[model samples]
Target: MTFKPLLQHFKEMKHYFIVVVLVFGVSFYLGWANSEQFSHFLKDQLEGLKSLSQSLSNKDNPQMWFFFIIFLNNAVKSVAIIFLGLPLGILPLFMLVANGMILGYVLSLQTHESTLSIVLKGILPHGIIEIPVILLACAYGLKLGMLVWKSAAQIFVPVANRTASAELKKVLTLTKPLIVIIVVLLLLAAIIESTLTYWLVHL
Candidate 1:
């Protein structure tokens, strides 16, 4: 894929980006706004990761906890996605923002050097695809929530007159494909992250 195309795609998903930014921004502001705190957190996480990586270097299988780790990670992601995708109007978005904040906070805790290593070892292996896939699902959830919001606005319409058949059809038409794509991507990531990544790291 052309770099330009990816950029354009991201450009079109400005809302998703914005939500992530707002969430991460608030997180950084609260947890690492101070230079000292940021630096300390960064150093700590880096050192911790470095130690862990070094320890794994001699392991016959570094991914001894592979299934457990991936399961935990997926569980967190799924729960967050579901909670944030709920059709409770903007509540899901708020949850999304909060999720972003927590991620940012954790990331900020890593030192740049360690962060780079972590990116390569912990993230890049599968995160290249996983992150985007999750974000797309989030966007779909956001879009779904928006539809529900619109439907809610018409709640006062007499029940007989307010047949939401058209709206339901519209949502399903747009959402079905999105759901399929997201699920496929998520599954692909899980496979890569769980199996391939485990072997690669251990090797």
Candidate 2:
């Protein structure tokens, strides 16, 4: 499928993208500035990830395992958020906030390396593709959430079915193409994270 449809979806749903960005930005700042308040929760998350990492490391061809794990985790979650948004968009928002905060919290933590070093060596390599792709998925998810409300309103107001159907078509039409885009980019990102970023951080 052509990437143009996904780009078109972005154009139509720019507002949702803006809202996602704003929410993510504010949450990131909160996570960075008030990390202590979130430490109890964030630490648990980190611990779980660390456990997973250690287990994966023991496996033969750890890098290959990492690639599969990372790509599947991200891809499945990304797709889930799109449909999970059907319930007033709560899950996608939560995912956006949690992911954003996790990033910010990690960046804010003190370490032997400089902040720039951590960013350059740890995040930028994979995150450049991973971040935007995730955000794009969330924006569509948010749009779907908004449509859910509108659909509910129509039950009472009784507007033309065509208008409602078209609005839905506009969003649903992007699903396949968007999933393809997310999966493809995230695969590349997984490769980078597993190989390049892993190598850099270890060194």
The C-alpha RMSD in Å for every predicted model, in order, reads 7.3, 1.6
Q: Model 2 clash tally?
A: 0
lDDT of 2 by residue, 15-110 (tens): 888998899999899889999999999999889999999999999999999999999999999998998887878888999999999988988895
Scored by TM-score, the top model is 2
TM-score of 1: 0.58
lDDT of 1 by residue, 1-203 (tens): 22343334445558865675465457546544443545565556557646865675556664554444454555466435633664643654554554454445555668977767656776687877876665555664565566566567678655655435455455445554454555666667767776777666556
lDDT of 1 at 128: 79
Q: What Cα-based lDDT does every candidate model obtain?
A: 0.57, 0.88
Highest lDDT among the candidates is held by which one?
Answer: 2
Compute each candidate's TM-score over C-alphas.
0.58, 0.94
Candidate 2: stretches off by over 4 Å: 111-113, 160-162
lDDT of 2: 0.88
